[model samples]
Target: MNIDVLELTAELVKYESISRATNVPVTRHLAKVLRALGFKVEMLPYTDAAGVAKLTIVARLGRAEKGGLSLMSHDDVVPAGSADDWTGNPFQVREHGGKLYGRGACDMKGPLAASICAACRFTAGDLRQPLYIVVTSDEEINALGAREVVDRSKLFADLRHGYGVICEPTCLQVVHAHKGSLGLTITSKGRAAHTSSLKGVNANLKMIPFLNEMRKVNESVLTSRRYRNDEFKPPHSEWSIGINDNNVATNVSPAQSVCTVNYRPMPGTDTNALVRRTRKCASDLGLKCVVHRTGSPLYTPKDAPIVRTSLALAGRRTPTTVAYGTDGLAYSEQMKQLVVLGPGDIAQAHTVDEWIEVDQLHKGVELYTRFIDHVCVQGLA
Candidate 1:
């Protein structure tokens, strides 16, 4: 059977590429498709040994030395919570009412299929700059796959001429800016002792007041008028306490406690300032807490050449900002101009019965074709 875009979507969904399992199968499958299209392919695997596995596929469709265009995407899909939540088997592809339903359908497999279809359609004589297909295994998990690809100096250096397109689902819209994220862990340490000793210090006791104080800090965030960017819904930084680990019997005083705080910072917000304030808050509570900066935020100018070209191809005059963050943060400094354009709505991603409109798939393939043609084939200014 021919590997058409829709058929490719079905094949990708058949493999349970959930983060908890191996994504090697899906990456290998995509590599096979790229290879059939006459692209040179390589495997860039990432493993932490403790069960975290990531893979990125790099394929070049012409002379490697020539300047090339790169299309990147992730193959991993977030786990489908509660099998009962889905109307059909989560792993099986189903079509209903003009939509294709399955895990990773919209969050990215659909776009990946469309991109590959566009590559197969392009004629040899039409090519100008080389076209590169980059498939990674862990974008759902903090863009781990893309991170590994960018870390390699040689990889980034070789394709520097190509304008990078992150084919993440955006319902065919072009996204230019996304917020940054910072995760902080707060820990409280104390001496453990028998409950009979009333004077014994219980780390749990210290945490109560501090936790209450942290609530105030979280509330303060909702009221702040700083870092305003009205383009995003409830535009401003958002703060929340992620995890609180304090479980102990009443007879014994617990020795340790931890609190994880996540902040989705708005554009231009001083992340350092927020981190410093959180550390001070912990100190005042008499708890020693260490704050670690998580990921960098991606910011691209609206007037950048690549952004202009992408928007023009999509027939839009302006770019949009999304609330979620992407690996774009990691490479923002080196690749200053970037955009996230793909098929599907972010709402369907990571949800049971995830799906992508068939029409979106068609539009995506055409968009990729036009984009590649304009940037790589025609080299239009």
Candidate 2:
């Protein structure tokens, strides 16, 4: 099969595989594409929290051996907030000034297309080892699909010593480290009644103390050197807090209020201690606390074989770190050598009229092909 990176990216962008919905359609399409390229495809299917069916695709070419190259990308993209904000349809790929404009064009689909095209460049007979391509779901919201790939995919299980690349937008730069994610949701419950009768307990009132404590924690995280990692730009763990009350009218007291907290953990940060601290606060306030998600940071040493090879392939002198997280967090558990490298700019992701440079797409294909050649075909690193 002859795969063109631009055309494949446009085809993938046509599928509205938003994080909230099922990614099965786009995943199946990719699976078909991989099969056409003589890849052995495996389907890992699961249901999301909303009871919607989702899928992750794992495809391999050449020998099913212990060591090779694995390229991973998420199939899900963030919601195209409003059509009115875009030049044309957000799902329709449009080329303007040598940039491909679409929802996942810069964020991931373009890099994903480049990976597919690179893998298709060689037939199975030409490979000394295997080449793995993984398409995961729910990367925009949570990394549940990547977790599933780590835990469930039999094909992935064979790549214990393999080199893995998370194809996230990095302008073709190599990333060796990124922050982790820890999320918490706290809920305060109360009885609902009319404010005129003054019989209802306001949930927001109960949540105020908790919020105040969280604010102090946030402040401390922002200022404390203990949570700082100088390798990243901001240096401190980014602590974010969000609040919501279900009541729509002032006449009625709110029956429930929710507070969501998100914290980014750097290397050496004690995430378990952070979770314990939040839980204790919620317990003292008699509020329900739930840990929604936790993902570890991807940390490969700059001298690691994968990082060095990826830096060489991208023509970079050193490996860098990013503030954002990727699926590497999950895959890193199994594959000790992993790096995040791909095309386009991270700034272009999740914005209105998102686009990726055509040159980046072509460069992405070239880089991935070099990586495959170095590892899978030539069996180097």
Candidate 3:
């Protein structure tokens, strides 16, 4: 079963597995393919917050007791927006000028195809250890699929002391660290009434103080050395704030106002303290504060075995850090070593007419094949 990487990538992109919808279709297809390729496939199913049924596929080949290489990629992609934004159908692959264009072409499906093709090059009997392929859902939204795999999958449990690769778009460069994310929602409630009556409490009035405080916090994070990590570009934790009110008419007093804060935490930064401060401010203002989602930053030392091997495989001299988050945040603690290395550039991801160079896909297959040969077949750490 020598899978063509480009064809596999095209097949994957055709599935409409956007983060908000169920990824069962694509995942089930992948499960079938893996099973045909002589891998034991486990389907982990769960319902998302939207009440949509979702799934994660964990497939293993060879001796699955422990200590092998794990390749991770997410099946779901961010929405491609309007069809007018793309040259062709965003759900279909369009190859031109030595590039493949599609929604997840660069962000993930291409890399995922590369890994599956690489693993297919070897049989279970040829491996001294195991090769695990994890296709997760909702990674673009909350990484809940990865969290579920980490919490429940027995196959994932067997990855202890193993080397892992998160196939995120890094242009084949080796990434040792990436920032984490903390999402907070703050709410203010008040009585609603016509503005002319002046009889209702204004939720915005109550939220104004909190917004001012958040502005101060955001400015502080942007300028203070306390929130800085020199290893990443721009060096400071990004604190982003957004506000919304459901009131449709300006003549009516808003009954509720909502504020959302998304903070990126670095490896050495005190994220808990920042959360505490936010909660305290909300409490003092009589606002309800909720921690919606939290993802830890991935930090693998540059000297780690995975980093060294990945650098060599990718032909890079040194490991670098990224500001974006990945499923690596969920698996970092379980694996002995992990690195983010894959095809395409991050700049091409999530944009209109997203694409991966044809040359990148070819090189990706070669790179992943070498990596599988090194860590799984050759059993080298």
Candidate 4:
């Protein structure tokens, strides 16, 4: 109950748990702290494609009661640029003028600390239901942690029908929906040939139609405008090329070309249909669409009780939506309610010398404590 949310946030920022760096140490660190706080902690470990170790820390306090509450956060931070570029050590927590400056301050570590502080207070207040702290790794790269949790939902059997709060920076606002995303690096291979002879197939030329086909897909999505939600910017699904990798020489034909395609699936857009149309295009073109990253969009109903309650707590008339993604959407279907709400401005996230206002951190702790009281303690509707 007496937890120093700001101090705890500073301690967490001291860990260099960047996305490229494994989060095992910080996770272990949090696990120890949670254990000391009388919470049951479990570690879910796995190895990524790069052979990097990853972990998901699920800590619970109170009975293993269904319909409990979950406070979610991703522990991984984006890479801090060169030390010379920063005014202070990015890993070392620095507070100046009431702003906590650190790599993950605004991005997530601050919110995670708020959750921990709230959990301590809520536990002391006599919780009727369980309190779950879902700290996942590898969220910056993708929704790896969310996917793992969904796949292994049975591990946290207590919170089966729970509501979720992804502690992503939202300036104390509530977000109920965002676009889902999938990215692919597709390649077309062809034989090399001399420019004048043209004896070999040109991969660059071969890729044009495929590229155009993808453009058509984008155009189709834009024109159809299915499931358009005006709350979101543009209000339409999107498909487009990201990186145009063409292996071509001025005098010789290109033997291989690769390009990155990305899809932002709007809520209600059929992801299966999108992928099916994509694969069909690749199949017909004899190209490969190698999927590299993907995540489900957030579309928690605006009228959900949790959303309505969160809006009321935030003193807002309507639940706004973020254009970017968060960890909650990936697991929204698992629960009756999920909302992305936290302190700090998302605009500050991923910026150099990232910081969260000290006031925001305080407000976050208070907000999370209220949520715990409403959902975890009182079991209010």
Candidate 5:
């Protein structure tokens, strides 16, 4: 079957894989396409703790040994908000003025199409090194699918080859590093009573001092030169807390309040350390602070061959780091040498009407083609 990158991107966008419940169709669609390409395909299935149908599409086109590169993208997208907010249907691809607009158009499906097309092109030419493709679920949902891939243990060793390219939107710049993010929950307890009862402690009142302390933690991040990375936009680790549930029904004092803090930690800074510090701060404040869960930051040196060649082909400077996390960290940790390069801009992703430049998509095709040449045809053989 002939594959048109743009059309495939459009077809992919049409599938509303909002969350795990709706991901089967998208994964099957990708698998069908890959199977037709003559690759050995595997459906790695797992049931989440919540018993969601989780599947990862893994296909290999060549030998696994001696190491090869795989192209990866997530099949899921965040739920589209308010239909009235978009000029057109968020699920339907609309093209005007050299741009393709739709949900997940920029978030990922755009790059996914480009990567698949590049792989098809490479396979058509009988590339020597193995080329693999994996379309996994749950990237937008706490990195669950990727964490499953890692936990499976044997998948990494089974790959035979190690390197991978995470087709995340990067506007064609080679993204070698990116920060890690963790979602934390903090809770404060108090006694409930009437507002007139001066003796009753307001949970809202107890949260104020702790919130200020959280702000100080964030501010401390801004001043920490140790966390600086010139490649990232903000160039610093950041932390912010929000009261997810704050209610004191006016006359009555609420007994409990919960705050969710989002922490984005840079490569040099240890996410664990920051998490530990936050927990201690919560402890010192006499509030229950939970570490929740965390992910490792991704960092691939710019000097690596894959990074250098990717930058040289794109004719653009390699970014130091992207503030947003990707499936790249898992790939890097598992594959050891992973480079992130793809089309579209993060700014456009997850917006009401996400779009990708047609020209950028074409450029991505060319870059991926050249990368295949460097890694498989020219470099591998």
Candidate 6:
């Protein structure tokens, strides 16, 4: 069966599946298609803290086995920042000049389409082991979709292979490693009183020491390792703090001071040590620290089969690394290794009028088909 890649991409684009919005309709659409193609489709629904209904679609082909290949994608896209910022409807697909334009045309939807088409090609072919097509929600916000799937270990016991693909916007290159993200919202509390009183214990003032300590911690993170891998652009983890709100009025001492702290840990760095410092600092300062989001950095060896095969398919020997996080991290607990490789450029991912070249879309499908052949059909021979 010949699946129309662009038509699938456009159909997904038209649904307006933003990270914060409901994705059931789009999930059903994908489920219907995968089911028709003889995949055992499973719709696993989950609810986040904010009560948003999310889902992860796991469609498997062939007999279940360990170390099988999996193609993964996220169903959610980043919010279209402003409607006025776009020339055409951001929710609908627009094809012009050999480019397909829409919100997730590059960041994801394009890869999802290509993966589905590529996996569809195996419907009539025999397989020694299984192949999986996984679509999860909440990647743009925090990769909660993949996290949820990973947490459900028993649900994917047979499919928790050591090899997998994260269909992010890698522009057809294979990404073997990426940085981890840790975010927190800290609040300093104190009694609110008239500024005239010196005993008022200003909440904003209580945050000064914490801020200074965090600065030093961040500096230490930068120098964590003597030599950094040039593969990662910055090649070092970064931390920053933002004072969301502080003094509300000149005459009133604020009752609370709120700030956000985010740290991106590079590969080979001890994330637990960094995490402990932030928590200990907040405890010593009598400030409440709430974890907002946390994603572990993924590091796969360059010589890994997934990386080697993908590189061979793309005719590139070097396996690159990305700065951003992906759904791959969600499956780290289950899958032994995961690589981020797909169609489109990362530069166009979150732009107002994001797009993927038609040529890139076709190439993505071809690469995926060839990958299936190399890993599944040839049995990694």
TM-score for each model? 0.91, 0.98, 0.98, 0.91, 0.90, 0.93
Candidate 6, residues 306-359, lDDT tens digits: the string is 677778888887998888888766666556678899999999999999999999
For candidate 4, lDDT tens digit of each residue in 176-288?
88888878778888788787996877787667888888888788777774646677887876677764545557777778888787777767677677677877888788988
1-381 per-residue lDDT for model 2 (tens digits)? 678999999999999999999899999999999999999998999999899999998899988888899999998999999999999999999999999999999989999999999998999998998999999999998889999988898998887579999999998889999998889999999888999999999999979999998998898889988898999988998679999997968899999999999998887898777788889999998999999758888899889999889988889998899999999767766678988899999999999999999999999999999999999889898
The regions of model 2 sitting more than 4 angstroms off are none
- Window of ten residues with lowest summed lDDT in model 5: 153-162
Number of clashing pairs per prediction, in order? 0, 0, 0, 0, 2, 0
Tens digits of per-residue lDDT for model 3, 359-381: 99889889999999998888887
> Taking the tens digit of each residue's C-alpha lDDT, what string does model 1 give over 1-381?
235789989999999988767898889888888887788787887784456666677888766553567787888888988878899988889999999999889988899888888888775456777787888766665667776777763556666556878888887788888877777778887767787987557676667877787787677777766656777776866678764545467777777878878887776777776677778878888877776535666777788887888888988878888888766755565676578898888888877788999999999999998988887788773
lDDT of 3 at 38: 94
TM-score of model 1 relative to the true fold? 0.91
**What do the candidate models score in CA lDDT, each in turn?**
0.78, 0.91, 0.91, 0.82, 0.78, 0.82
| Cα lDDT, model 3, residue 337 | 85
Those runs of model 1 whose alpha carbons end farther than 4 Å from true positions after fitting are: 65-67, 123-125, 191-201, 246-251, 283-293
lDDT of 5 at 380: 46
The lDDT, on a scale of 0 to 1, for candidate 4 is 0.82
Candidate 3 clashing pairs, residues 3+ apart or interchain: none
Please estimate how well model 1 matches the true structure, expressed as its whole-model Cα lDDT. 0.78
Give the candidates in order of TM-score, highest first: 3, 2, 6, 4, 1, 5
Count steric clashes of candidate 4. 0
**What is the alpha-carbon lDDT of model 5 when measured against the actual structure?**
0.78
